[model samples]
Structure formats: C-alpha cells, structure tokens
Target chain A: MAKKRGRADIRERFGFAVKARREELGLTQEDLAAAARIHRTYLSDVERGTRNLSLVNVERLAAALDLSLAALFGRVDAGADGA
Target chain B: MAKKRGRADIRERFGFAVKARREELGLTQEDLAAAARIHRTYLSDVERGTRNLSLVNVERLAAALDLSLAALFGRVDAGADGA
Candidate 1:
C-alpha cells in the first residue's frame, strides 16, 4: 500500500474514499449515482479515479454519502497514511 | 457571519478559506498563484467563489498554501459553521 500510495493521485485517493463509503452503506454505483444526481457513468468514472470532477460534484457525492466534505477528505488523508 | 453562510455557496466558502489562508501567510494573490502555477485571474476567480475548479487545481492551491487536502476542506467545513 505504501508503494502504491506514491502512484495514486488525489483523484484516486478521493475515489477510493467514495467507493469505500458507498460500499459501507451497501450502495451500488447506480444507487449512489441516483442519490448524488449524477450520471451513473460519471460516477463510475469518479470511482475509477479517471474524473477530475469539480467541487460541485464532489459536494453532491459527499451529501449522498452522508459525509461532510471534511469527513470525506479525512478518509482521503487516512488512506494516504495507509490506514 | 451566520447570515452570510446561508447565501454562501460551497465555492464561496472555499474561496474564503483560500483568502484567509493566503492572508495568514501574508501572500498576495500573485504570490499564491505563482506558487500554485495557476493564472492570477483564475486564482482571483477562485478567491471570489466563482470558479468551480477541479480536484487537480484544488490540490495545487492546497500545496501552495502548505496544507493537505483534508486540512483545506476542514477550513471549508469550519466556515460552514460560521467560524
């Protein structure tokens, strides 16, 4: 994980946090996308760490996950620490 | 401040954080923009809460401010609480 961290950009880190939370809430991509009011494919791209999404979309995802923006990024920071 | 929070979008909140941090560090817009390798006008737009910037650029600002993404978002969250 430490070795992988070097290669994982912030987008990937953020995506991992989103995916982790979604799975924790027992949501599929489609379900989460609907909740966030974003396209499923866009959500898929976000989860794949391929999308450089803006803050508006990021906030939507956070709201959908019932996480504050700070909490969401806290997950990202935790992941950076290999937690 | 509480009154302002209701009307302030996330972008505006984020801009406030950037401006606050830049001020704390005694850096002008030009200085921070140069550090972030972003255009001064773009940074200005961000500071004005008008730019819905992507994560890549967000990271740049965080780096320039010597903050982690989590820390930056923490400031945003703080602002939401009228802090």
Candidate 2:
C-alpha cells in the first residue's frame, strides 16, 4: 500500500527540485530571485519548503529556470518515492 | 523564436488538463469539487482559468483525480505546443 503524502512532503520535494536546478544552473539565490522577480528571502523560504506557492509563482520560477512546468514537476516526482 | 507564454496561458492550460481529466472520469463539476474539498464555484473558476491556484489545492485536485502530480503536469505539457 502506498502511503499518503502530505502537503509538507510536496512542498519539500518542490523545494529540493528548485534548489537543485538553481545549483545546476550556477545561479545564486539572489540571481534566481531577481530573475523570478521574487525577494531573496522569499526564495529562501521557498527553498526551505515553508512557502505554499501558487501557480503564478511556480510559473515565474519555471520561466526563470528555463524549464517547462512539466519538467519542474518531473523533478518533484522523481524524488517522490525515495527522497 | 518561442513566443513567451503568459501566466494566463499557463492557468488556462492547467485548467484544460483538469477539465479533461475530470470528464474522463465521468465526474461532474460538483463531484470533483466535493472530492477536492473546494466549492463548486471555485472549481468553476479553476475550470475557467480564472483562479491562480496554490500548490495545496492543485495537490488536492490531483489526489481527487487519482493522478500523480507529475502525471497531471504531463497533461498540461502535452497540450502545451498544440493546444
């Protein structure tokens, strides 16, 4: 039986994906924050999985990261089962 | 050159994916709304692409539709270029 994943799990997975992508792109948090037009602290919060971001913000991040929405979520799904 | 997609486009595509999945399940708007614990009117707004929904609500809808988050987003990405 599969365990039900909660909101926190989802958020954390998303955060991990974002952080990984940022690192892969050699982007500092400030760089991504500026590109996404979000505050650095807000980006920090998102990276920490404390922010319950909406679709618009998610899109903003995806655009800043040069990723499609599916690609971004694909990372989240990849890490779902094990991490 | 790729045309930049606006937030409205993303929301609309996501909404279309949701609507399509809901229909594939032979579910009414009310049924999906109840299953996702959202108001029918809110679901209507979501279907219309007027609401910038949060991740929690998106997850709720995904769970209600029996789709993993990646699967749900795959639908959105599948329709991205053509529709």
Candidate 3:
C-alpha cells in the first residue's frame, strides 16, 4: 500500500524552493506576496512550509516568481510528498 | 496587469482534472478517498471543485490517483489562476 505522508518534509522542501527562487529574483517576501496579490502572512506561512496551499494559490505564487507551475515544482518526485 | 482570481473557475478546473483521472482509473469517490487515506466527503468536495486544498493534500490526491503533481496539473496555464 502507498504510505500516507505526514507532510512536514515535503512542505519544507516546497517552501525552500519558493524561498530560493524568490531570493534569486531579489524579491522580498512582501514584494512577492504583492506581486502574487496574496496576503504577506499567507506567503510567509507558505515559505515556512507551515501552510498547505491549493493549486490556484500555488499557481499564483509561481506566476509571482515568473515561473511555470512545472518549473516551480521541477524538483519534486511523485511520491515524495504523497502517501 | 495580471488578475487575482476569485478561485471558482480554477478550483473547478482542478476538480474536473481529478475527477477525469479518477474515472479513468474506474475508482469511486469512496475508493479514492480510502486509497488516499482521506475522508470520502473530502474527496467528494475536492472532486466537486468546492475545496481549496493545501499542497500536501494535493500531493496526497495525486498520489492516490497515481499521478505526478505536474501530470495532474498538466493543463494549467500560468497567471490563469493568479493575479
């Protein structure tokens, strides 16, 4: 049976990806949030891997970073985050 | 300027995608939820486009459906779901 994940590590990896990309673009969290048109706190939480976001929200964040959804999550393996 | 979305359309699209894949596998909502280790209602909600799930949940769903996150969302366009 496929294992259900606890989610901490995967969320952290996602957050790290977002943060790394943001830094590469020289955008602050607020700037990214503003560009993404989301609340700064929400972006912050996402960056901290503390928030579980929807695809739409993830899409928004990827756009704010000027990246594609695939590119944004290019590092993930299918089962790495899921059970 | 990019538009910030209200989320209804995007969520609907995502739900449609999930449902299509699930049906392709011939799994019922209860079966899918059980395989995903989530509640049947939650699966129903997601399939109905009524839920705004977190990344972890999305990951779980994709895993249950035997899909990669990218493969699961292969039809999306950037900025279509974001501002």
Best candidate per TM-score, number? 1
Candidate scoring better on lDDT of 1 and 3: 1
How many Å off is the CA of B48 in candidate 2? 0.5
What is the DockQ ranking, best to worst?
Answer: 2, 1, 3
Q: What local distance difference test score does each model get?
A: 0.87, 0.86, 0.75
Can you tell me which runs of candidate 2 are displaced by over 4 Å? A1-8, B1-8, B81-83
Error of 3 at A19 (Å): 0.9
Pairs that collide in candidate 1 are none
Q: Lowest-lDDT window of 10 residues in candidate 3 chain A?
A: A1-10
* lDDT (10s digit) by residue, model 1, range B1-83: 13334546889889999999999999999999999999999999999999999988998898899987889999998887563
What would the per-residue lDDT of candidate 2 be over residues B33-62, giving only the tens digit for each residue? 999999999999998988889888998899
Which tens-of-lDDT digit does each residue in B1-83 have in candidate 3? 34444533667667778888899999999999998889999888887878888778877788889977677767443324543
| Candidate 2 docking quality: incorrect, acceptable, medium or high | medium
lDDT of 2 at A21: 100
Kindly list the per-residue Cα lDDT of model 1 for residues A1-83, writing each as its tens digit: 13334556778888899999999999999999999899999999998889999999998899899988889988987777553
Over 4 Å off in model 3, which ranges?
A: A1-8, A78-83, B1-8, B76-83
Better of 1 and 3 by DockQ: 1
In candidate 2, list every pair of residues with a backbone clash.
Answer: none
The model with the greatest lDDT is 1
